[model samples]
Target chain A: MNINLTPGPSQLFYTVPDHARHAFKEGITSISHRSKTFESYFQKATEGLKELLGIPTDYFIFFTGSATEVWEKSIQNLVENSSMHLVNGAFSNRYFEIAKQLGKHAQKMDAPLGQNFSSIPITNYGTELIAITQNETSTGVSLTNDFIREVREKNSEALIVVDAVSSMPYPALDYSQIDSVFFSVQKGFGMPAGLGVWAVNPRCIEKAESLLARGISIGSYHNLPTLLLNALKNQTTETPNVLGIYLLSCVVEDFLRIGIKKIRQETDYKAAILYQALRAHPLMSAFVKDESAQSKTVIVADCGEHSIRISNYLSEHGFNPGEGYGEKKKSQLRFANFPAHSKEQYERMVDLIENLR
Target chain B: MNINLTPGPSQLFYTVPDHARHAFKEGITSISHRSKTFESYFQKATEGLKELLGIPTDYFIFFTGSATEVWEKSIQNLVENSSMHLVNGAFSNRYFEIAKQLGKHAQKMDAPLGQNFSSIPITNYGTELIAITQNETSTGVSLTNDFIREVREKNSEALIVVDAVSSMPYPALDYSQIDSVFFSVQKGFGMPAGLGVWAVNPRCIEKAESLLARGISIGSYHNLPTLLLNALKNQTTETPNVLGIYLLSCVVEDFLRIGIKKIRQETDYKAAILYQALRAHPLMSAFVKDESAQSKTVIVADCGEHSIRISNYLSEHGFNPGEGYGEKKKSQLRFANFPAHSKEQYERMVDLIENLR
Candidate 1:
């Protein structure tokens, strides 16, 4: 069997196929979102999300199409004129661009590729909200808790948001430090793609309402206020990806059974093993040099032209990792260490990588 | 086996379980969307949609969250300032409200519940676009071809968009009379909800470009230009419901194999038997009066106080139809005749309905 290790949409959580069978046999996917049956599914999924992530009761969670969509909705509902972005790679930079595309005064602090905020005192420059990418999937870099805590301390008046897309369930985020945070399921949750989970506190709702009072059109249908109203009713404003939500509930339950602390510890262990193997490789090395900034979930290696040979060798062993993104597409490889990957798999993968010519 | 006669999310196409099983075994859900594997799935789905729907070469098909989303997107891309709508019931009226919410000059012509336009010279009120819910799922009302043709001929200069949400693959819409149209797969296509298919011709793209040139912010990401630009690459602006798209492609191929003409004919026959049985019922009759306006797929009946008793009987017999929408929630039941429900199942439903006390 080919062991999928790509960052997003990587490997099925082993339990998904069986859970999907249950969804099909029970007609879970075919039930109306407004029906009591569907409401229960929705409730289970959202509640699981809260318990697994330790989300506060005051924080409201909403589902969107993808995490990329959360970027658009955030700018629409939270910011009136200006927003700040800490851009370390393509995904973070795209969030900044989304703000600009929505006709906002978007300011960005740029960090070079494969690098993240390692120091304190990141400024938002009077913007109404600051977007921090906690995990940069594109370059396998991440902002440390020290830097994030510093940002929260300095920008108490501004709305703080984080993209925990590729590193969630492992992040154990302090909800008090951020008003809003979002992620997609395919990465950290080890499910199929399509559903984006967005958690926002009461402050975020208040900000959205204020925008509405000021005659700002948040959106046509998925206005944050509207999403909140439906979420309160235990459903979404539109017919959602019911199956995705249901499967996510199953995986989150598994995560709960396994516990988040164990998942986080395993992720760190796997990441360490991969990085150590990268150091021994002839043509590959850890891309993010700073230990504090290196991502524990998505580990990148600068392989130059040897990426192809390494990939071929891994493929022969029934292993695969995600290709490098953007400008480094041809010269780097990103290995995801999400919960779907076990310690045994990582050890085997490390052996193969170290054995590569 | 309970026959899922509910309009949407009612029943899987039966082939779905096997296809989903195949998807799971192949790790289809976990692959990167940008990979060649995913592109092939995207290309297959879009191309299959075109073949099945007879979508012209110039028309671009894009996948969105749901048909409810297409309502917002149509307003964003096809209209600059003003648009007109034909509102028959809740779903159609919601589209009109979406336009107003998006800060557009939205005008509407309202029809009472269970009514449709039998006569025409249906006007667009000099608006740039006319939004028509081709088959309004709310009350099982539909606009006839004659009325759609009149609107097209009367306002040749304006764009004409359609919402075929709950009644596509059955309505052989004249794409020549419309600039854009969309539908979700749950209803007529017999798939799970969450993906909306939008087809827009070159004129729609031009209108969007002109609006952009005029400095109007058409929101962010999933913009028409960006969607089309990425569609040419067989992908989307963000990570899409990759599995949803894959399943839809499989279902559409099945549709092609059985042929659209056969599906429509089967729908008509099934609707006829159900409506005929409704006439024999003591407490229910066809919700729609005009024959041409009665939906072929979503056959709604005015059930009054007896809806529960009838629903209970049907439930005992292993069958369930959809509840009424909006104000008619408890007073009506909607029987859906999608391709997934076999002829034998419909005949059995008729027997059950006719024998109801």
Candidate 2:
């Protein structure tokens, strides 16, 4: 009965079928990784993901442990000596941490919190890779498609990697120009957490191959090349989240039933209504500076004088508004509208916020 | 009705409770990585893993994509020098490949096909770590506790990692002497395969810390330190298999009720029933060279002349035995027995095999 407003693990709109439930009950735990039944599910999920996301036919999608893992994987496989990072929020800043940890040469172009890199000025930083967060969930800011294309052109040789953790499927980006795109399933995909999805271009694959061909050994599990080989066959070299795979397959099927365009439009309207409600509230104001850059799926707002009190009030009223994600923890709250959310639910959420105001 | 004896992705014996299912349905997917709920689950899973395994209080456990992921994590995080591998079957052999891929020196004491590791005499030639499979599911061979303890005492300085994927929760190993133990939940735990649990000793933590202190970035997702910190706080840095976590919790509760000791005894009896049937069958013979080394959880056997034909026949009659894993393809079948299995089910499987024979 809890209204899950916390970003990432947002609400799922569908129930998993009884057949899948029955499959979980009887011990089928010993089946090997390459088993036919598992392969079927794996094949379906990979194809479903590609189709749902409109990933280029040449680009292959694979699942990993988390986007955090993909962050490291992208660096290990793609970055030769140096990479450029556009840091706008918490999740964005973590990419530099991952790059530095992997002993890669990484330079950061950081922006203040609640601000986004709508356009990164052309920089001759001598970097082979440029990583940016498409949607900064912590600050509720987004980098639009035009911005991404500009950044890609800014450093043509620098393979672009987009951390689309919070933006995908709603504040949707055209990933044609990017070399690699990373996001976790729990957030935008509307499935349970723990599965990270990545779309890798041929250039990224070449980078991975070069790393392996040379003696620069990237760690297993996170290695994109190894994962790609297995993923192509609709199987992972490691044990995958079997139930998550099943649930994700169901979620994808649901997504197909309600076309992506419909889902996107519905989500956009939901975001507009929620934003209108928040802006009308006397005690709250939007967190992001630019309206264009503001995330359509999540709203970051600074609660007036009694942010904590208001958040608690909303929670008490059975609507859970999430605590701030970044530096403005006490003052800001995040409200996310996942796909399949109803207008009535947003209105009710607004009603709870208004009562608190 | 399918007897998924294909190793992992194997048959799940227990049923998931309504609470777990309800949590899964009611937005277990919606909780963000930053949320207190996910953090609670993470911390509880770590603690629960330790408690269930009777691991020492000083030990820390981290979850990963799979045991295969750990192979890379260990190589990346712990192996500064060469590693010694004890290869009895398919899974064990892969470590050598992983080690080579990671640019680490590796020495292997390989057993012949259908054989167990008889001796792994450690040499001081850059062997900082020694890896072994406690139970070789491919060959149904198990390394005895006495042998493991002897090897550990002999090479006290060397980090010992045991892949106990197929032998955990039954015929349990003492975690005190082992530095790191990796097992997927699917095999002996009677859960799905996506979750890999590692019980790491203080030495392993020290190794990780030392590596981090030395600025050896062990990638983000595979970074055990980050995983432990978040796990200790009851949260994962990424989305976790929340349904799998809930199911594991339920399964663990059931195990606690039945008692691991009682469960082991029950598994032993069930295995004996199958083993007895294997001996009685004229067409079948145990794959493992030594009966003492045979796995109590899985029984691997070779059909006299037509392995696939026999497997197909038995499968048609509602008994699905596991095929040989990896390069040790075809010609062999395996039977898996765990705590959740019933004597009646074991008898039925045995009868099917007998009738088919």
Candidate 3:
């Protein structure tokens, strides 16, 4: 009876296809990790993912345990020297912290928490990588493509690694300017979590291999060259999440059927409806200043009271909103509209929020 | 179709339960990850796992995306340099490699790759932590409790960490003497890959907290302390593989109903069947020298010819034996007998191998 508006294990308010269920029950449960059927399934999912994301042919897609694993991989594979990081929110700051912990030469361009990612600072040419959080799930602030391009322009030699965990497929991705992009299946993919989707361009792949050749042992599981070889065939070197990969295939088929542009439009309409409802509310204010920079996927707002009160108020009535992540613990709440959420569900949520106010 | 005999993601070869299908379809897809019902499912699964494993009250059970995550967490929180590691095979060797990769001080007690893990060399216990792999899946070896007790007696201050990845309920664990144990659901748990089961003793928790109290960041998402807090409520900090988690619950129920001893008996019989078949062939010899070290889960053998040829030969028919891992490339092939394999299936596999030979 509870409505999940929390981000990430966001919500699947719609019916999962019967074919996916059948595959999980009849096919995946007993299949060995070494079987060809699983190999094909794993490969197809990765290929489908690459196609859906508009990644180039040179880009290889890998499946890992979590997007958080990508953080370690990024630190291990990239960032040999000082790197510039755009830290506008929680996940971004986390990346900076991870880089520091790995003893990587790294620096952060800090934007205030819960604010739009404005101008990124210039870095020295020796910076081997430039990192950013594309969709700041904690604050609902998204860094536009233009901002990324500017950073790329400033640091041409440095590889660009983007944590696109929350804002993929919906707005569609333009990987032409990026080196590597990573996400988990939970958010925009409308599937359960556990698997990380990584698309690495040939340049990034070569860079990772070069790092490996330098005798830097980037933990066996996250080893990019090993991952690339398996990813080429759409398989993981270690045991993979078979059911999740199968379900993601179903989701990919649905995406191709509906088309990404149509899905984006539909999602836009849903976001508009929710935003209109929020604007009408006297007690709430959007956390991000500009609507353009705000994420269409998640709605972060100051409840004009502590987030716990508003979150509790919403939860008591069956709707659960996102809690403030990072430092904005008390005053902010978030609402996520994932791929599977319906117009009716959005309406129900708004009505519930209105009643709470 | 191809039969999966990879030990894990091992072959399911049977139909999944009906209630699980119903739950996935009509019951729990859209339920909030934080909802009471969803929490109940998660909470019940953890409790069920603890009961199913006969875990002590003092032990804490948690969930992670993969057993690999457990590997990183074990190092991040548990080991503090001076830890002794027993490396009997490829999988066991990787643990110390990961520890070294993470800048932890770990010493290895090396056993020949295909030999049984005899005992831990106690003299090198510079740290208060000791790790052992329970079942070396790569070499088809299992370590006995007597070996564990011998190690414990040598280093009483050291916490014992066991990677029970390939030897969970199927072999029946006696955690009464162990501090922490980890396994993946993909193996003997009879579920799809993705979800990992982590159980830690109270002493390990205290040690983790003490380490955390210092400036050591256990990396976000994989942090053991935060993971345990969520585990107490049967929840994870990030999105979990809901489908895999649910399937694991069904698997636990089935395992408990069947009884651990009966399951072990069944797996043993299947292993014996495969071994007898292998012994009859002139072109084949058991991979490991010690028959006692041969795992009930998988039977590793020398195909006498190239392993790839034998693997391809068996796979051309209905049989799918696992490939040689790491440096054991040309000589070995592994025959896996998970609990799900039927007796008829085993006989058919033996027949196919005999015919192929």
Candidate 4:
């Protein structure tokens, strides 16, 4: 069997195939979104998420089409006049651009590729929200929890949102420090690409309500207020990805069974081995030079022009660690260390990397 | 043994379980959205839809989170000042509400509950687009083909949009008369909820470009320009509902194999029997008074107070024709006569209705 190590939509969670089969057999996909059956699925998924993530009591979890959508929704609902973005990679920069496209006065502090946002100070300057991509999927760089907390300390007035797309279940974030955090299930949750989970605190709702009070349009249908309204009733504003939500609930429950702390420990151990392999390689090294900023979930390595050859060679051995993203297509390789990936698999990946010619 | 005839997410196409199993086995769900594997799924689904619907060459097919989303996207990209809506049911009225929420001067001609838009005379005064819900799923009401065609003729300068959410593959709409049309997979397509297919002509593109030229915010990431840009490359603006898209391609191909003509003929046959049963029933009659206004796909009956009991009784025999929508919960019952619902099954439904206590 081919081991899919590509980031986001990587390896299916070990339980997914069984859960999906069960879902289909049970006619879970055939049930109406307005039905009590769907509400149970919604409640299970959202509650499982809150428990798994250690989310605060006042926070609300909402589902979206994809995590990329959360970027737009967050901007529309939270930011009335302006927002600030900490852009270190392609995905992070796109969020900033989305804010501008939405006609918000979006500002940004950029970092070099394969670098972290630890260097950037949070100078909010009247920005309604501060967007930080906690883990940059494109470059496999991440800001430390300490840096994120510092950002909150510096701009406690601005609503802080984190894009933990590629590194959820691995980040033990203090929700008390951030107003909102969003991620897609295709990544860390080990499901197919579809559902995006957005956790927002009461402050985010107050902001959206304030915008509504001022007659400023937040958005249509999926604005924060609308999503929260339906979420409270154990329903979505629109028909959601029922299959995805079902799978996510199953997987999150599986994670709960295994415990989040154990998952994080395993991820850390796996990332350490992979990075050691990259460091010992003859022609490659970990992309993020700063050890503190290196991602434990999505590990990127600089392989220069040999990236394609390395990817092909690895593919021959039934391993696919994904090709480079963005402009680094020929110069980097990414290997996702999701929960679905076994410890044995990462060891094999490390062995393959260390022995590469 | 449950025969789900709920309007959307009702009956899964016969081949769905097998196709889903095959997709899972083939690692379709695990494939990256940027991969060639995904592009193939996108191409097959889109091209198959075009052929099955007899969509023209100039029109591009794009996917969204749900059919509800196309409403917001259509308004955000196409309308600058005003758009006219033919609101008959809940879904149709919501589209008009979306436009107004987006700060557009949206106008509408209202139709009575369970009624058609035949009475709406297209008085387009500086309206950029004319929106029509070809089949309003909520009340099982439909606008006639002639009325939609007349709309285009009356407002030749305005873009004509048809929300064919529950009637696609049945409505052999003359694409030349409309600039855009949209639907979700779960409804008439007989797939699970998630993916929404939108067909837009080149004129819609021109209108979007014109709006863009004037610096109008036509939405972010999912704006027509961005969607079309990625769609041309057999991709979506973000990581879309991958499984939904895959299943769509499979189901659309299945539709093509059976032939859309045959599907439509069967639907017509099924609807006739259901409507006849409703007419002959003691406690129920067809909701739409005018036969021409009644929907062939989603059949609604005026069950008055016996709706729930009738629904539960049907469920005891393993048939679940959906209950009433919106305010008519106790007064009406809806039966979805989709392509997946066999003629024999509909006959059984009719016989059951005849013998109901």
Candidate 1, A1-357: lDDT as tens digits: 688888888888879889998988888878988888778877888899899889998888899989988999999999999999999899999999999999999999888767776543465467799999999999999887678778888888999999999998889787878899999999888888999999999999999999999899899678889998899989999999999998988899999999988888899889988888877778899999988889999999999988888888898898998789988889999998888888998999999888777
Candidate 4: Cα lDDT at A105: 93
TM-score of candidate 3 relative to the true fold: 0.83
> Residues B123-189, candidate 3, lDDT per residue (tens digit)?
5375677888988888887787777777777777888899989877765566766799999877676
Q: Relative to the unseen true structure, what is the C-alpha lDDT of residue A226 in candidate 2, on a scale of 0 to 100?
A: 79
lDDT by residue for model 4 over B89-133, one digit each (tens)?
A: 898999999999989899888897888866655664568989999
Question: What is each model's TM-score for chain A?
Answer: 0.98, 0.93, 0.93, 0.98
Q: lDDT: which candidate is best? A: 4
Q: TM-scores for all candidates?
A: 0.98, 0.94, 0.83, 0.98
lDDT of 4 at B51: 94
Every model's DockQ, to 2 decimals? Answer: 0.84, 0.65, 0.40, 0.83
lDDT of 3 by residue, A105-166 (tens): 77887887666656435545468888878888888988778777877877778899988898
lDDT (10s digit) by residue, model 4, range A1-357: 698988888888878999999999999998888888889989999999999999987799999999988999999999999998989899999999999999989998888888876565555456789998999999998888788888888888999999999999899998888999999998788888888999999999999999988999888899988898899998998888898888888898899999998999999999999998888888888989999989999999899989888998889988898778878877888999999898998888778877887
Fraction of native Cα contacts kept in each candidate? 0.82, 0.84, 0.50, 0.79
After aligning candidate 2 to the native by TM-score, how far in Å is the CA of A26 from where it should be? Answer: 9.0
Docking class of 4: high
Lowest summed lDDT window (length 10), candidate 1 chain B: B116-125
lDDT of 3 at B156: 76
Error of 3 at A228 (Å): 2.6
lDDT of 2 by residue, B1-357 (tens): 656665665667556445456766666656665666666666666666666778788887777767778888887777776898988887888877788777788888888777665644544434788998988877888888877887788788889999888888776677767888888888777676677777787788788788788876666655778877876776666666666666666677777777777887888888888888878888887777577788998888877457889888877867677776655457777778776567777888788777764
Considering only chain B, report the TM-score of each candidate against the true chain B.
0.98, 0.92, 0.92, 0.98
